[model samples]
Target: MTYFPKLLTICILACILGATTFFYVKKSVYIFDTNYFKINSVSRAALKETGSKQCKNCSEGVPNLIIQYGVGRTATTLQFQILCLMMAFLHEDEINDVGCYYNRRNLVKKYNVIKCHDISWYLTVKWSKWVFMTSNHALLSRRLNYMRGKIKDKNTTIPFIADIDLVSRRGHYIVHEYQRFFGISDEKMQHIVEYLRYWDVLRVCCGMQMSADWRNHLAPKAKYKQHHSYHSPTYPACEMYNISQVEHLLVNTYVFKKLSHIGSLRDVIGKTSTVDGILNGSYCERCNTNISKMHLKFNQNCA
Candidate 1:
């Protein structure tokens, strides 16, 4: 009997709470044939938080497994970037510990850290560390509505939601439990921030058609409307709710405030799909520079 069908059923239920945040343990594994996960006896690894300098050499034993799980619109992409940066500080061989290099789009590795929006996690007897990302319910709903272009006005709200209490508890966990878990030093943090800043800038450039090459490179198969970077101007225009509370809490916890410094609704509204369109935006040299740098970092030959 294949578990594929059952696994899909489990995925829908697990999507709500499992991916958002939770750790479970049980003595035995039994297919209850229900939504609940009957976690197996997997040894949860106790990792000692080490700074970037201390990670100069890889440990002798099996490298600790790190997994970051979250629902959509909870900054999963941003967290993925942060986790990748964290993975890079490890010894050269361990640097490829992540399952795949996003920039290179390669998967020749046994991933040390796994990021999943889907609650498809399974228990392995091997040691593992889990990081569950959560977001405020209001903020999450707003993001969802925006991404789907469902906004009508300030009163407009999305039916889907994030758990409020989980968001608060996770915020506290970030403060107390694993502040240095990623082992990012000050210098590394600065670089990560700069990288994030440039990343968003390039995103804005692509959205505004300031860099056609980047848009083509990033979303070759996607149409302008279907592009991952696509944003509806109505959502932003109608967004009167202040998600600043969540942003503030996240910034205090993870120092991820640079995200707000990126492009705005005007950029999205200004996008043009035509080659001959007289766009007000000009090509960004910095965007091209970062694109080349990224290509080089991923061992891709720059054009």
Candidate 2:
């Protein structure tokens, strides 16, 4: 049970939604079996009549948890970066001009079009905060020397960074490369990686899903695609069970709440995955009872 397939599921869903966007690509959105998701209340748009249609100052009046305070993500977070930035835009974070550190900063054209050209977010604490929160390496590298100075002067809190293992791992090579390329000191880099806080991608995915309920904004012209590896359990599971259509793309309130606390999608293999790719918990609350039912349904689908 690895996090690989769960991410694939998300990628698939993103491609499904991408089909409607301006940048379209040929792809299949594998709609998994949802006999387990016996959600009676149909998922509906849960938007608020908050003032201007735009988020003038994203951080200004956002209720707690409006934008997730993620921590300790690595280079393996490429796809999640797209989703995170997209989520941030929905929340009205001024990121159009903020070059995304996807493999390289300010590299992606879509995000480039999103920038506030000529304007720089480099001076703001929000920009620094987001870089640290989401572990945006590009901006962090450019600002690291200044950021360390800020911490010394008590100007800002320390941002999370990756450690030796997490950064150097196979899908995480970029962390090291970026750090070396930026000439970050061993001591500072070590501290960034060792700091406490583990915002798992699986958990982030679920959080993003919650954001999806209200923060449904998206790019109309960005091309989207799904990627899955040979080791992805979800691929095999899909092949075996073969769910043709997904009734509701949304996870209900109960499952949503349940996923918030105890999801281990990062650890779960892909086959017979949950809608949110949430891992089934050992303890069964009413919500988890539904998860149990979901597992049963998935097994039944395969049977």
Candidate 3:
């Protein structure tokens, strides 16, 4: 009777352990499968989009829309957070002022009031370092000059000007250093630079130049409509350039060669498509095109 009890206890303990292990493993597998499936759907969509040559004007050739960076006076963190959130919600091609905060009323009234998160590590690290480094002003100036020089080489029609604030002592130093490094001595150019500097300082110190201000400056009030659909705009369309013009620019300009490094929405689509295919055994039309012969050809010769 004692041995019987012991055996019963052992059997019960084994059953419990086995049940626990099975449940744990099952949950983990389910989670993994869910994520895998989502990724596959996104991937397939991207591949299909790439293959279909749909939105060809935006895809194959187009200049990135003009991106305006806004610097606010107060609520720096909030502004950064909002900008990142907007990036997440909005299409990459949509040209709007980022890196600044807007009045809640103004956001609702004047622009599309979409919720965005902070996604500006580039500004936080790269731009902020150049702005804040007191001792490395000269180095910063040299770097800005080099960047401008490269821009000049790429597009002679576009005027290359480094805008810095004149009101703040730090801003003045940055402008002086930049001018010295770049050998920019033209009186008109200097004045324009000074004006840009004034605007930036006013933006940061006075809180006058917020996102709303930028919206008024760049886009028409009527054009600021909220989009309910999930379509993300491409660079050319977002920039408001004619599709043909964007295509020509993309063909001529070699600047965006680095886009291949950063994984885009296409990657997401591809993953989603693959997962869906595996699970359903049904080929999605979009996913099919992505893996099609024509798509393979484009992928090989995307350059």
Q: Against the true structure, whose lDDT is highest?
A: 1
Clashes of each: 1, 14, 27
Quickly count the clashes in candidate 1.
1
CA displacement after TM-score superposition, residue 78 of candidate 1 (Å): 0.6
Residues 1-303, candidate 3: write the lDDT tens digits: 699999999999999999999999999999999987765444343234322243233212211121122232222222222222223223334323322222211222111221112223222221111111111223223443343344334432111122222222243233443232223345633443433332232222111122332222233355555422225321112223232333333223221221112232111111111112211112222222333323322112211
lDDT of 2 by residue, 9-43 (tens): 99999987876663332222222223223221111
Tens-digit lDDT string for candidate 1 (74-118) = 544444444544555443344433442222222245555455554
**Model 2 misplacement above 4 A:** 1-136, 155-160, 163-223, 227-303
| Local distance difference test scores for all models | 0.35, 0.28, 0.29
- The candidates, ranked best first by TM-score, are 1, 2, 3
Question: After superposing candidate 1, which stretches have Cα over 4 Å from the reference?
Answer: 1-63, 97-111, 138-179, 203-303
**TM-scores of the models, in the given order?**
0.34, 0.21, 0.19
Clashes of 2: 14
* Cα error of candidate 3 at position 168, Å: 48
